[model samples]
Target: MTSPAPAPETVAHDDLCPICHLLLYAPVRTECNHLLCASCMAQWADASTLTRITPSSLDMDLSAFDPNYDPTPDLEAGCPMCRTLTAAVPDRKLAGFLEARYPAAYAERRVEEETARGSRVGEDGVQGMMILIGNRHRAERGGDEGPNKHNWTFFVRVSRPDIVKEIRVNLHPTFRPPRVVLTEPPFEVRCLGWGTFTIEAELVLNEPYGWVKDGMGSRSQSLELSWMLDFEGRGKQGRVRAKVKKLDGDADHPIDVDARASPVNLPHMDHQHV
Candidate 1:
């Protein structure tokens, strides 16, 4: 008999794009820290400018008129809701997170995106998604001693965290236990360091994403990654500009995208990501 279906992935509403109201596909983080799909933002720039709104109850008196009351969103300016008017960068790490957490949904979006953009992936499954390591640090006034005096919390923002059985982080060799194992959502490791160093991690996959070979999947899978830390300052944070690598050498089984997480939306269903 066939095996039971893998457990469905879970994610917060925040992970959903405001425009499409679906898990973000190719997320682009605006300067204002709002995340929306690149495609959706492009459409907004092309047509959905937050132009002046007609106030149903405006005081049309001379005293009510303010000198600086501009409401129209700048053309291709900024986020539609906030109107910050700045550049939006592609968030590769988040995209990877989506793939690992929402395989079916991500695949569907990938196909839809490719079709819309007239692009295509190799016959093989979607490019394997890699484990992306993310972190944030703050200046630590009281540290042992060294130029790298900060307390940084390294974290992985993968969705469907349950699929990850455990996250093993390999720290500097000098530490008593160079390898640290974490078993929980928002897998994070807070550490005090005095020097910038490279960190390696291995994530063991569980049901739904584990132990698959050469394509397709069974339910037990794992991925390994390494990211070098740059304690420059001001939490500028390292970029996800690292070399591209496939996740676990294969994507989740090629499940029909339409089978889950319906991505369809109707006009007037404004579910902005506030």
Candidate 2:
């Protein structure tokens, strides 16, 4: 018989037995998937224990390690993938190997970990009364479709019908010298208006900025008014809302105010109005 195709070379776990080599064991694996005896491995793993490999160093070893206990430490319990006994373990480095080798498993672990912590909700809903504004625009009032040269005045009125005190108005930065006028209690009101004109608050006869912009631009200015209702009560809360009313008849109609842009006639004859 042809010399049996050289019997596949085989390695053993105890090939370099620490007992015979007189060195600490460094566990290694075999081709047949058997663990090797490492001389250095045993020494490092059990360095703190009272285990003596060499008789001459017995005194020091006895003091450090437990003499009665035989420490048999395995680098790893078993193969992570196959769950079978392996000759060697990568130890802490095993995480990287497993993640690269098994992406699906790694992802599953991450998801499981996150789920165990808690669920996340993006935002909270308002339980008490709160006001939100939007859709503000501006343009010359009444005169013509094109840009006007008249100044406009827009009035915003807020009615707080609650036992509230100290209301704050978060006016948009663009509101020229935003002024807060307090009128009445159990209902605080403020008036703010501005525009470009020479006389009293008047609307421009034509679009002022329309020359550079088509149908888009600052057709109206925006103002954001927030109210900080400081009222004391168990269930009493205040609500705020704004309505833009034309203060000057120069504009065809008063611009309904929102948290967006609104058109107001520019002031005219500043010297006389001031």
For residue 200, model 2's alpha carbon misses the true position, in angstroms, by 26
User: What TM-score does structure 2 among the candidates reach?
Assistant: 0.17
Clash count, predicted structure 1: 8
Candidate of highest lDDT: 1
Candidate 1, poorest ten consecutive residues by summed lDDT: 265-274
Residue pairs with backbone atoms closer than 3 Å in model 1 (clashes)? 78-85, 128-247, 129-247, 210-219, 210-220, 210-221, 211-220, 211-221
Model 2 accuracy (lDDT, Cα): 0.26
Candidate 2: stretches off by over 4 Å? 1-127, 132-139, 142-160, 170-177, 181-274
Per-residue lDDT of 64-173 in model 2, one digit per residue for the tens?
53432222333223332344532243132434444564455445544543364211110110001112211121333446654332232222222211312122233334
**In order, what is each prediction's RMSD in angstroms?**
21.4, 32.2
Best by TM-score: 1
Taking the tens digit of each residue's C-alpha lDDT, what string does model 1 give over 1-274? 9999978767579888898888888787777888887766654553222212122221122234243321111123447779766546668899998888899888888887777642222122121122335556677675465343567766654433445567767777775456666777657677776666777766665533432222122223455566666565533222111111123444533311112121221111111111
